[model samples]
Target chain A: MDDARRGAIEDFLRAASGDPALRITGAALLSGGAIQQNWALDVVLHGAPEAWVLRTDNAATLAVSLPRAAEYALLRAARAADVTVPEPLFLCKDPAIAGAPFFVMRRVAGIAAGHRVVKSATLGGGRDALARALGQELARIHSIKPPRADLGFLGAAPADAGLAFITAQRAALDRQSRPRPALEWGLRHMERTAPSPVPTRLTHNDFRTGNIMVDEAGITAVLDWEFAGWGDPAADLGWLCARCWRFGNVAQEAGGIGPREALYAGYGDVDDARVRWWELGAHIRWATIAIDQAERHISGVETSLELALTGHMVPELELQVLRMVETAHA
Target chain B: MHEPPDAANLLETARALLLAELLPALPEAQKMNARMIANAIAIAARAARDNSTFPTPPEADLIRAGAYDPGTPGHDAAVAMLMDIARARCAVSSPRALDD
Candidate 1:
C-alpha cells in the first residue's frame, strides 16, 4: 500500500461510514482472479473493528468483462436476493482513489482452490451437501431477473441465448489469426441443435467449484460476479456440471463436488436435455477462453506462466467437446 | 555434431535435477512455479521424442464449410481426424487425462 492510495481510502472510508475517527489498520493484496485484484483491508470505526475486501480492475483485463460499477451493482443485487455473496458496501468510481474504479465489500472466509475443494471431505458439509447448496444458491441468483435500472447495462435478454452465444463465439473465432477447424465444427453443431430460448434470468456466467468459497459448514460465498448477465438459467447449471470445471474429479460432474442428481435436487428441478446441451456449449466456451488466455500471454499483453499453461488446456477441452457432440448426435 | 547427450535426454536430466535438487529448496510460494517448470520440461522432452507432425486432415476444411451432415462419409472421418489430433495434444499436455 502506497501513502497516496492509503490517504484516499481513509478519506473514502470516513465519508462512507460518516465516522471522523475511522482508520485503516492494514491492507494486503489477496491472490487469484487473473482479471481483477482483491485487497483485504482491516479497519477500525469508532473502536469497532472489521475486515473488508476491495475489488478493482487490473491494468490488463479480458475484453468481455464488466466494469467495476456494474460488478458492484450485481453484487448488491445478489446479496439482496439472499444469495451468499460478500455484502457490497461502497463503490469508488474515482480512479484517483485506487488507481482504478473499485468497490469495498465485507470479507467472507473460505478456501476456493479447485484441487483442494474437490479432494476435501471435511469442508462445506462434504461433497454432496455442498453441491446441493451450490445448486440452491444458483437458483437464488437466477431468481433475479432483468428490467432493473441498476443492471440495465447488461442489455436486453437475447431471444435465443444459446444461439446468441454460438454466434458470439463464431465471431470470436473469426477474430483469431489461426484457423480452428474443431471449434468451427463445434459451433456448427451448436447452431444446428440450438434449443429454443426459455425465459431469461440472471446467470452467473462463471459459476464453478473454484469460483465458490467453502468452509467446514458450507459455501461461505459465491465469488466473481463480473461475468453475471441475463441469459438462460440452464447455462449456469450446465456450466456447473461441465467436465472441464470438474477439476480432475471426473466422476463428480457437479463442479467435482457431487453427482448431477444432487445438484439438480437442490435447484428444485432438472432439465437434463437442456443442461446437457449447455454442457457441450461449456466445453466450446472454455476452449475459446483458454486460447484467449494463451494469446494474452503470447502477445505480450499479460505474460504469465498460468495463462500459457491454460492455453495448453485447449486440446483436453476440445476433446471433451468432440466426445459430447458425438454422443449428442448418437 | 552435438555430443552423446541428445536434446530429450538433456531436458530429462535438467528436469530431474530441478525436481530433486532445486524444487525442495524453493519456498512454499515458489513451489507451484517450480512444478510448472518441471512440467514444461517434461512436455518438451515428450514432444522431442515423438516428432510426428500433426497436420490438419483435409476433411477439416470441408467440415468447417458445412459440407457434410452427421451421418455422411466425410463427417465421421473429420471427427476421427480431430479425435486423433486431440489425442496427440493430450500426449504432450496431459497424457493421464486420456488414460480414463
Candidate 2:
C-alpha cells in the first residue's frame, strides 16, 4: 500500500473506531487470495496491541462472489447465528479510502492450508473433534434461513435446490471452451437421481478444510463467504466430504479429518442419501471450477502456473465423478 | 523422420534435470512453482507420446435426452464405454486417478 492510501485508511479507521489516539503500527499483505486482497493490520487500540484483517476487492471479481459489503453483512449474520467467524468491525464503501470498497474484521489465528491441516494430527484437537466441530458450525450457519431482510441480496431460496444446482453447473459447463463428457454424464446422473426437495437454508458454499481455520483447541473460524448463498443445507455437507477436498486423505470421508458419522453426530439428524446426492454435485461443482480457474490462464486473462495445473485436476475429478456414479448405481 | 531425442524424450530429460538440479537450488517460494513446471512437463511428455485421438461424441446431448438413462437398452453399454474413455484420458493426464 502507498503512503497516501495508508494515510487515508488510517484516517478512516480513526473516525470509524472513535479512537483518535489509535495508530497503525504495521501493515503487510496476507497471501493466498488470488481473487481478493487481505491485508494484516497491527494497531494499538486503547493503548493495547491488536491484530485485524482488511479485506478488499481485487482488480477483478468473479461473477458469483458477493461484494465486500455483502460479505460484511454475512459475517454479522453468521456471528448472530452463533457460527464461528471473525467479528466484522467496520465497512468502508468509499473507494477513495483504499482504492476499493473494503471491510475490516478481527483476525483469528490458525493454519488454513489444506495439505498442512489434513497432515497435522495435533491441530484441531484430533480429527474427530475437529470434524464434529465443523459439522456443528455448519448447522449453525444453516440456522440462518432465507426471507431474511438483511440477506435480501441472496434473492429467493430455490424451490428445488437439486435442480437449481444442476442448471447452474450446466450453464457453467456450456461457457467452457471444451466439452467435458464425464462432467456431462455426472450432471445427467444427478438430474436423473435428483434428491427430494428439502428446506432452503443458508449454506457456506465453499465450506471445506482449506476454507476453515483450525487451531489446537478446534475450529476458530470458518472463512470465505464469497460463494455463500441459500441452497441445500446438505450441499455444505457434501462439499465438506467431497473426495477432492480430502487432500489425498481419502480414508477420512469427512473433510479428511474424521468419519462421516462423527461429523453427522455433531450436526444431529441428517439424511445420508441426501448428503450423498449433494456429494455427487460437489464433484461436478469442483470440476467446473477447476476448468474455470484454468481458463483464466488459458485465455490470458491472468497467467499463473498454479492456475494452469488446476486444469489438469479435472481428469482426476472426472474419474471420481464416474466412480461415484457407478457406486451410486450399485 | 524425427530426431533421436524426440519431443517426449526431451521433455522427460528436462523434467529429470529440473528435479535433480534446478529444483534443489530454487528458493523455498519458487520451489513450488518449479514442481508445478515439472508436473506440466511430465503431462506434456505423456501427451506427446500418446497418438490416440479419442474424439468425444455428442454424449452430452444423448445423456441430456435421457437416451442412456438406467435400465434403458444401451444404458449399461453407454456407461461402460464412457468409463473407458474416461480411463484413457486419465492414462495420459493422471494415471494415478485410475488406480481404484
DockQ, per-model, please?
A: 0.59, 0.65
Cα lDDT tens digits for candidate 2, A122-192: 78899888889988999999998889999998999999999999999999998987778788889999998
lDDT, model 1, position B32: 92
Native contacts recovered by candidate 2, as a share?
0.59
Model 1 C-alpha lDDT per residue in residues A132-207, reported as the tens digit of each score: 8998999999899877898998999888888889888887777777877777778778878878889899999999
Worst 10 residues of 2 chain A by lDDT: A57-66
Off by over 4 Å in 2: B1-4
Candidate 1: fraction of native contacts reproduced: 0.51
For candidate 2, please provide the TM-score of chain A on its own: 0.98
- Would candidate 2 be rated incorrect, acceptable, medium or high by CAPRI criteria? medium
| Candidate number with greatest DockQ | 2
The 10-residue segment of model 1 chain A with minimum total lDDT is A174-183
